[model samples]
Target: MDRIRRRRTGAVAGTLTALALAVTGLFAGGTGTAAADTRAVPQHAVTGYWQNFDNGAQVQKLGDVQDDYDIIAVAFADATGTPGQVTFNLDSAGLGGYTVDQFKADIKAKQAAGKSVIISVGGEKGAVAVDDAASASAFADSVYALMREYGFDGVDIDLENGLDSTYMTQALKSLAGKAGSGLVLTMAPQTIDMQSPSNEYFKTALAVKDILTVVNMQYYNSGSMLGCDGKVYSQGTVDFLTGLACIQLENGLAPSQVGIGVPASPQAAGGGYVFPDVVNNALDCLAKGTGCGSFKPSKTYPDIRGAMTWSTNWDAGAGSAWSKAVGPHVHDLP
Candidate 1:
């Protein structure tokens, strides 16, 4: 189809996946994302970020939630710090208005089962742009307010473009304190230049790594800015992420504090699906069984603690699921 790339609205467009299928009565298509299901690699215990690239089945997903994982972050930034004047988009109602109690219950249940739940703030377009650190802090505080009100275990800082994290690092650590329960202070920093540091990302990262629980480098996005070497070379399926890991380590982030970013869709595509498109494609491939396919997480980044997806719903359906892909590599960590 020439990959014409239809420019969907931020919401619609951002939701698109490389596994690309228009859903002709529930069907699957693509190659690397092959079908029917995947032989699930071991899911990492370090995973906690979950994007809100879902529609409808969100409650069902949470309803069936188990705590085999370490962290569980939901997509969304606080609306008060929104772009322009929009308000209240990234909230509990993201999928199906999951109540605060329901969310708390999910967190508690998962915690009981040994998992952690975090509220992800500032997605690709949720709110917050990296124009300056000052703006980023405003956005971070807005998100912080929401976390406190809802009694969340923590918050994920994913300010993709609009505000330089340098301005928000202090705010992040500060907000991290308000996140509660020794709240995990995770941050998602973009890779800018290695020679020195664009927007002083490395120094900012090091400054906050101690207070930060995890710093997920959006690998693919990081590669574009940092260089394609991570994907084009290295030992893992996506060398960019491997390189990113190195960068984080060099910047003072511990392996346990750093995680490779794998979204459900391509950033070039529109910054949607925080999960692995490979897993999405693989599930659809499994559902349709060789009808069409794309990629799978197991076939992608085969190393590290594991991987994180945007949400639990994108893994929905009678077949082709994110959870299924967690089987083989579930015990990836020590």
Candidate 2:
């Protein structure tokens, strides 16, 4: 992926929407002109991933927070972007046996507990629901209704592996219809510019930046192996930066829409792994002598929003240390 890629953290500070989104607030239906507003303002709601785990029992466990991150993405394989092999059952990971009532209740509980959990669909897992566009639309309709039924603040289309724009666009549109003007719709895709990412993920996102909140570009690793190492490596600083820059520059992705996240396993983790990208990035930063547990703005791209790690459980002092750097990147984003 692009070495010019990125990551960072912080509380939903005061300055976030204050600078960039102010015009939208004033011109956005002409609601207010003199009040400094703040309260669940989905304005640049920077995201970080929580890979897999339902009910917050996994890494997002109720009492396991080592530190605070801006956004928490809950893994729901059913909502995944896996190719065209998805079905109504989806991947069983997202819907599982949990009904809409049960799931939404969980979301409400998490938010009440001071944590923001967004539903993440599409991943290395198996959530693809069939290649047919109709099927995809149906799937999106169901998920969109579910988001409403469950009261989720937003949805994420993490086509980490499957699906395409045709279906993805339908799905996003479905979610947005039910969500209306207040809900969020995001997509996470690889930085390598593809023709169509996640059912027109790029085009649709640009077309509807108002609803499509974040376009998290996987920067650390993407495409194929560096050789036969069978392991993924972080793109050098220049490659990463340029790659991500290309994504935003051409895709019509807003500076706020573009996001950076950690891929688990400093090496390759396609199998079954649950850990934060902090350790991996930190280790690489250490080897590169850039020093781990730090966040820096891209000299060329300062409109960056937020950074995310694959997993969250602090493995060692390294993971905890990286958490400390989250605030600087998130709060100081341009």
Candidate 3:
């Protein structure tokens, strides 16, 4: 997909303001009432991205999403006329007459069923920028607005364009302040973005580790990269999954915050599409240190968060084989 060449470009901005906000305590304090209302996520949960726009995949309303997914991230919230701000527009006409009310209702029903429905900010084509304090604030405000309007649990950062760790950290902290501790913040960085702790995306994830939920690093579409072992590993294999995940686990992220993200079907991504058993094996290998391919972690991470897929719609097009097998397997991780 030429993802590497499409990196987001721009110089970092609003550094002084970001630091000022932090020093003046503008980032402190959240709504206590909202904390009590936060939805509790499972220790071992499966996350799936729900496509808001049809792309040759099965079209589904929010309610049509299966129960196997613990977290349903609405594929994308579009970049607005204002930089760093985003908004959602349900493709009612495209979704076969699904209305805004029905979409909102479906989100509520999913939450009522103990599932979290959040808005994902970016995708392969996402370009929303939060490189400064004003933009950062805009990002938080608009996303929170969407949260209120649609009953979303929180936000997901899938900004494939690029990210500024400094302002993004501030934006999320401001978001947590308004949304409370219950805010479910997740990130879906490309595999290369997470290969090092010093990367902007990795730094942002660590900067907000307290409120951050899981970092489901995309393990496909990437050719080969260095694992925690400092050796090169190719994608679409058990070693590729566990070996790369080791980099995050061994770094600043907690065992509970790491997840293995893969394509739900061959059509879901350009490359690195493995069968469901490979995903399960990688999970078992990481959690139990068994069922491993070539690479194994130095120690087992029984508390490892779980798995994530590109799109739930693709899984449905393939008879739900990805979720049918991977969903139960993720929940069963020990």
Candidate 4:
């Protein structure tokens, strides 16, 4: 999301990587069991990011996040000194004095309640790259270790600056092979990164669509981009959401694999923040061919996956206005 900072920091240049996950069903007794071979396919999703640090918005325990959220992605893991190596720099200091064990326990509680807690790689200024097979293998191996050690359900790719589709695809395939069917592979590419099917991000998404869970393209912090209709749509409007999402839906991506990602509050992004109603309207227009704005999709994507937000912490600061309003609407969509 922070393209400017990534350019100036020089951390974004390196390449190498790996990541993967395994299913552990949360048992009632604070213990975990092997995940069911067939888990419920999520028809509607409400995904939120949990920043490990306190950033003005009230930091929350992983379990304290609202139950409405189906998937909770931890903000980031710092790309380390080795290419494809990363580390989660968490501690009692940033967690309001809660220890790492307590944090892991809370993550378990959420998982027990049928919610997923995955590690998100990258952010406004994440410095991770997977540009070759060696780096790709390293990235997968490191991520798999993290998922095993921390009990994460999966990994979320949110690389902000850019990606190499060739190697990223290889890294993701390796990750999927290790994690198996229970792994939830999601992405949060910036708007420009996903502007068209020809883009690297889109190509990567397509390359891994079989293993991919969803592609929540960030619709915030973007100025303007061309829609499927070839007309430019400015962000922060209903037209922008529908028009842009149309590109993915009309392309190779199944409706269920596409989600519209937005900021939980105006403060969550530099620009392109719209009211929750605008988001719901876009959903309705895309999935039901109703509640449309000026630019409506030529075909309805009735099974499109639900919405995603930048951070649940910001939503909490705004009295959870975004989730409270949009979560139920997504659930009700037919």
Specify the highest-TM-score model's number: 3
Model 1 poorest 10 in a row by lDDT: 29-38
lDDT of 2: 0.44
> Model 4: runs farther than 4 Å from truth?
1-41
lDDT of 1 by residue, 1-334 (tens): 0012101232122222311232111111111111111112123443534444343333343445433346666655445544422123434554467665765666566666656566766665555454455555565566666656654566676655444545666666666555533656556654432212234555566566556565565543321322112222211133344433444443334444555545433322233233443433322232223212222122123223445543343333323244555523445333
Q: In order, what is each prediction's RMSD in angstroms?
A: 12.3, 11.9, 8.1, 9.7
**Candidate 2 C-alpha error for residue 73, in Å:** 1.3
Worst 10 residues of 2 by lDDT: 28-37
Between which residue pairs do clashes occur in model 4? Answer: 16-84, 17-135, 17-139, 18-139, 18-140, 19-139, 19-140
TM-score of every candidate relative to the true structure: 0.60, 0.60, 0.89, 0.88
Ranking by lDDT: 3, 4, 2, 1
Candidates in order have lDDT scores of 0.43, 0.44, 0.82, 0.78
Supply candidate 4's per-residue lDDT for 233.
71
Looking at model 3, report the run of 10 residues with the lowest lDDT sum: 27-36
Higher-scoring candidate on TM-score, 3 or 4: 3
Best model number under lDDT: 3
